[model samples]
Target: MKALLLVVLAALPVSAKLVSREQRLDLVRRARLRQAVDPSTMDLLNGPQGDGSFKVGEAVSCKYEEKDPLHPLGGHSPKFPCWTKSGERLKVKYKGEANPEVYGEVAGSRLLWALGFYSERMYSVKIVCENCPADPWTSTKESPRAVRTFEPATVQRRLKGTEVSEVEGEGWKFSELDHVNPAKGGATQAEADALRLLAVFMNHGDNTANQQALTCLEGDPDCKAPVMYVTDIGGVFGGKGYFTSYRHWTKKKSLWKDAGNCVADYKTTDEKSNDPEISEAGRKLLADLLGKLSEKQVRDLFLGARFDDLSKRQPPFIWPDGKSRPLTVDDWVKAFLEKRAQVASARCPR
Candidate 1:
């Protein structure tokens, strides 16, 4: 009976066999070590077919190839460096499990590609090897792992014009816009201009992760004046969704109304939530900045349309209860302008 059992086990397909805990632990260990050695280097290891070796400072490119039936969005792929002898670059194809989490990897890879780095392939490596004490991780012994390897020259060619310098203190950094301290004073005009554009961009993109100011400077401080640019664009519309209404309870009506007054309120709430110094500083800066813009301009910038245009259209104002009334952009703009003016007056005091 024992001999029969051994024979049956031997006949089982390799892919069908489960990996032992020790083996899993080994893989985890190797992955963690790889991450510690270089956090950016092992970005692709989370994929299914992302096995193989890579050196530090090597450029890699990857893309999603297949969708997992269960996940329909996430899966794995191999990582390819920019300068392999075979002259291969680009994630030619993806073959592995499709899961939503895998979609996140694809999203991340797309972001990196947009930022301009070149390499082919991606894999899943361990993040904390020391934390994992079970099966150790190992690359597949099969030749396919090697066959997937490609030359780095091809990656360089594809990355031509996509390279973004990853210089610290020179590129993008994050910050808050509404907070101001008495000692720090308000943001300068230039800072306010940048922050205004950034706030619109963030709102349009549905980004809420960063409520502080961020600076993206080009080049080194000693080398030359840094050109400030937007660092985080991930909050844009395609990545997330946004809402445009505020809830207010009217004492007279004893009912809730969609005030459309929430955006500024939200910003104010965010500002006051910060430390006193930072909050004061941001308030002063924003008040000064808003003072420069006409109420019409603020409406146009945030609402994506002029009050006149909205008035001409006379769009219906639909209440949350499904009742609709004729309303125009002017109506919303007038209310918003009054509220903002009140806020500015209270906060800035001319």
Candidate 2:
């Protein structure tokens, strides 16, 4: 019976789509207020470890793949691009770091779901073994484009602005998804605002096209409006120096006044501004969703990232303390909860 079921499932069409920025914007434009964001876009988030179990698979085998020179996914960390298989299948980057990238992937996806935005379904898995198959899929590289990078001078100019919200250095530039394809593709004001809010929440500095996707319908590449997914989400909870800043955004005063105006400099500077990105309803929804997380859920988020007893294991990055030792799980959770409280306070009804 199990074999029969497996065969039946295999026969069924696989409608998985990698949603892109352009496609997401189009959906937002057509959607009603707070209705632009689709929950089903990241169906994988509802998997076995959505609560934050750091197990990608048991007895995993990683097949090494080629790295793209033009559009590299792993910035500084040595990227061992490989095909991962345990129960679920994924093309993963085996980046064994002092702080693994899986933590960021888990955190970003979790928050995106809580905040009610389309996100990628990612997991932090342990690779027990490696078996590099001769043929492995790698990301294709496009022709070189003179993409702008934020210089030090630009950061200074941005900091001088009236609004406190600002993206750090080069690589943190806002995605040109809308600008490049305004007529056919582009986000609604609300969707754009939500993106900015998400960036602030995750301390997301990487706004490049690679970080996002516009997946097509089931087996249909022609379906451009299928779904959207934020691909490069593991670059959060860090600094704002690069597109994937390792900075964290825990302080309330450091962020925008509200989720609606996260992109401070661009809000007033850009003439193409439209409606607010995140609506009151949206904020309340996010607050409610985040508020509903149980203690287990919260703990699981960090635990899945392998955050636990400091004595037993140290954290990845050391920001607010010793340059050598990593932060404690307790401290990390506390800071996260503090930020969550701030989010609820500002957005939720008093």
Each candidate's lDDT (Cα)? 0.26, 0.41
TM-score of every prediction relative to native:
0.30, 0.55
Instruction: For residues 183-261, write the lDDT of model 2, one tens digit per residue.
Output: 4443354454455544555565444544554333344334334344464566666534322222234433344444444
Most accurate candidate by TM-score: 2
Candidate 1 steric clashes: 66
What are the per-residue Cα lDDT tens digits for candidate 1 across 1-350? 00111111111111111233442222222210000122222222221122343332134443212222353321133322222233432222211121111122222232222222221222222121111112111132231221132221111111111112222112212232233221233334334322432233123232232311121122321211112223223222111331222112011121002223212212212333211221233344444444554554444332321123223333366678999876654555454455445435443211
Judge candidate 2 against the unseen true structure and give its global Cα lDDT, from 0 to 1. 0.41
